[model samples]
Target: MGRKINFIVLTGLVLVCLLLGTEYQYLETAQGIDSGDTAWMIVASAFVLLMTPGLAFFYGGMVTKKSVISTMLQSFVALGVISVLWVVVGFSLAFGDSVYGIIGNPFTYFNFNNVTVSPNPAFSETIPFLIFALFQLKFAIITPALITGSFAERIRFRSYILFMVLFSLFIYSPLAHMTWHPDGLLRKLGVLDFAGGTVVHMSAGIAALAGAIYLGKRKEPIERPANIPFVILGTGLLWFGWFGFNAGSALGANTDAVIAFANTNLASAASMITWIFFDRMQHRKMSALGACIGAIVGLVAITPAAGFVTIGQSVFIGFVAAVVSNLAIRWHERTEIDDTLDVFPSHGVGGMVGMLLTGVFAKDVGLVYGETKTFIYHLLALCVVAVVTFFGSLLLYKITDLLLRMRVREDQEHRGLDASQHGEHLL
Candidate 1:
């Protein structure tokens, strides 16, 4: 019944969009747009859009059966919630005219006012600004969705929704503006984030860590994944979608895009191999879970450096990230905090490592080229991101709690979020 209602609502929305007459009105610019670049960007946007559902499966598969629906719903809902939010004000906050280099002027693109079919050379020379905005909307949608993994099966849906809105408005917008906007502070400082190592992964990962700490532990923690095959399937989807996540940052079908695509695959393969081998050496047996986690860690580690580093550097980045993240996960297991999906280890730590490695291995401007300036700025940016996300998430969590209790009741938790929160259960 609920699914039917949702489907109807979505269908209505689509029909409305169609009826309103969506048309491409290209603004005249001195620089002409390229069809090839536009076509690739169109495909790339779809690829990036697929990742949220891919993440839904990945996170959904990691939890017990009872919480599966709720967990998956958390990610799926972001598609609706953030998509609406992004168009209304989120895009302007993220990519509008620069305001003191900290945020975009909301009025600049409020309701996507000036966004058109023509290229915005300030952002991309070939792709339409609307396409670029939509591409970025996908990123905004995924970042908050990524946090659901940490506090899965425990958090209240209302609180999560509120927090997602607040986080998007406050945390994500500023970071995106500072890092990606031409006159933004981080971009001016020469911070290299080809993709969203700092903006997406790191921000989500740190916020996850804060939530995990705040939420404490699940009453009865399940050590084993409920469905290994589901996890494997999710991992495969995530891997497939990641090409867009990394390469699509190039915003065109060019050399940088090609390099990013190749680097993404190579790094993931290297990390997977390294993770299983490391597990075999340490525990006397390789685990499928380790392989999946390693693959994701590699993907995260390579994102910031995807277009900046050489293939060899990408392999190194993946291998080292796998090792470090593995250790971080192991250490986290021994602690009291319950990060349900090891979000901090895999994404938070991997993103940090990737950002640092980008400083070290980036072509022409890396530490290897004696460019200590880029390296130092990266460190500073990492610290700023860490502090902002951590504290900001904490504050948002508290505010959400005040408005609506942040967690399900103890009884509801024991009953499982699927039945308790969604009134559904896996048969």
Candidate 2:
């Protein structure tokens, strides 16, 4: 979910409600100190922002040196591309007032009619709406960027630009509504993703699969990572930013936020150690890349449950999610599919694990307003979304491949995509 969940996302919008579900004239009415939560949110926002660059480094390092510049360019591609789209249309299409449980109506495109800075009725209605829009925009920006890695070495720049537009406008917007909007199908089914397990991470992972299949594999899919150190850098920066990703979901400086922050740290630590221990036992030496991957798995696992579960529960969630994703990725390697970054097994499988565990581990964490049969609903929702996302992704990949000759030609692939597609050399 490392797009995380709605815990903070939901809490930050409750303009008319109080801590105890009391009708409140002012969310800041109590101590009048929005200082702590507001300050934390400010920091959390930065953390989340940093993750995008971190992702660029992570993905870029995995591509062949010849394609390094092209790979890194995708991050730039997302930064420039999604930012404008979010402001002009993407925001309204997602968070706009619902239109019968479909896409959100464009109630405020181009900041149309000057949408007020009023707080949403969902959180505390204290944080400004602009803040909400920007926060979610950060999410929107990073997601399509995530998919770029799968197709990194071969996709035509023009085709990718077109795909990005359609993805944000058609695919991302409605899906966001389907889960985040009040009447959304997932929400209506009692699904509780505090952030974006299904909406962002799962969806991106699926789309990554689609993009990979459509763009086809790298000219040489077997090329080792260009810089393992860069992978470590990617892992480090991502782990650091995740604090914001999970904790910021609370959107305020509260106990829930603190719980999220701590869980993010702990789960990653546990996962890193577990992967090192398990892999070292199987092989002779521990691998830095494996540990970093383990840490990422930990981050993905705790995303849905960061605010919902106890610390002890967090350890369990991280462990289980890592182990499952690890096994799944190994299984994936034996197949014909060439996911350059293994986004599906890692993010997709890990996200499913996180979302389902959220159902199982959600507790009466005295912080949030309502806490119910936490785990079961999460599990069911995870299964349903996984099925939909997986099948939907497969169809899209097939259709796109059929129409566009998704994969690079074998001759070009043998020559390396950077040279084959771009008429340039790596250096």
Candidate 3:
């Protein structure tokens, strides 16, 4: 099996190398590109890319010491897997010419043939189309990484790599096309996701839920976090990168970007406070874990509405989302499904709350403004996304399980993934 997998991977790499030879000409024009926006976007792209590693640390510290390295590697590997996939067909399937408003034509940007430094007026008029694609690629990279937390300790590393690739191409790409593309069905309905409440957080969260249900429980259901300091460092990095994640969605350095940046910080702050205080109300002591989770949930909840809502609304969004997700965690604990890190509660529920609140608080067309259309469409879009992501992910998991068996052997689980899967361990 190892030899077969290696052969398949190498063959694919060779095919990609051959395809690169077809593009003999380069696009050298930078017409109509704004230097200011371009510069910030380049920085924003890097900031967003940092988040996957941050997530690696964030998730790594929450598992048992034995599972730590494997957990972190799952997140870190997406930086390689998704980057390559995105450049090949993932970007085309997402932002290529619309195929019935549901998906993109894969051939439109095959091998990133036409994706160049020149501005694509349909997506962004100010920055180069290449920058926009790179920024969106970061979002894609972190998404499947987020799902790793759900089935963390017991999943086969190779199986996970396969699942990640499938999830990106089929599930994540369609959602991105539908939500972000100009000709997308959801976009036409005016479902506003300023950053990625719908595309990133919500999809990852629901898929996490599906994964937890599918994978069932880990052998050792309860374990202490491996390292709290790692969690803190991870949280700080996520928070810092999120400024780029949300603000950069504005696609230019303008008033909307400023507003999104402020709202991002304010929402996260409010959510952190709300999370810890709410824990106290529940007779649970406020801890570093609680604070970190709260901050992340706030970031997730405010993502869709980052540019569409005000600072006060963002605060409210964060507070409400934290409370909801906190309760969700409690409910999940009482159930049979073992979401290893509460990925669904923190990301899925938080995203749902954010998407709904964006419908309520979006500047002009929100429920608060007495415009029912946008809010109504948001509800519809949420339901649609939930069904597609949840069911689609389950099917993909089944396919992957058949192909490579998603879970490891019971003996392997007992030995810990660090040793069983990777042949490495912490000192």
Top candidate, metric lDDT: 3
lDDT, candidates in the order shown: 0.90, 0.72, 0.93
Candidate 3, residue 66: the lDDT equals 91
List candidate 3 stretches off by more than 4 Å: 21-27
lDDT digits (tens) for residues 190-261 of candidate 3: 999999999999999999999999998988864689999999999999999999999999998899989999
How high is the lDDT of residue 378 in model 2? 64
Error of 1 at 403 (Å): 0.9
Local error of candidate 1 at residue 64 (angstroms):
0.9
User: What is the per-residue lDDT of model 2 for residues 79-143, given as tens digits with 9 covering 90 to 100?
Assistant: 76677677666888887777777677775444323333555665444565556677777778777
**What count of clashes does model 2 give?**
28
List CA RMSD, all candidates.
3.7, 9.1, 1.0
TM-score of 2: 0.83
Q: Which ten residues in a row are the worst by lDDT in model 2?
A: 15-24
What pairs collide in candidate 3?
Answer: none
Give the candidate number with the greatest TM-score. Answer: 3
- Candidate 1 residue-wise lDDT at 159: 74
lDDT of 1 by residue, 222-304 (tens): 66667877778888988888888888999999999999999999999999999999988887478888889899999999999
Better of 1 and 3 by TM-score: 3
| TM-score, structure 3 vs. true | 0.98
Error of 2 at 144 (Å): 1.4
After the best TM-score superposition of candidate 1, give how far the Cα of residue 414 lies from its true spot, in angstroms.
0.5
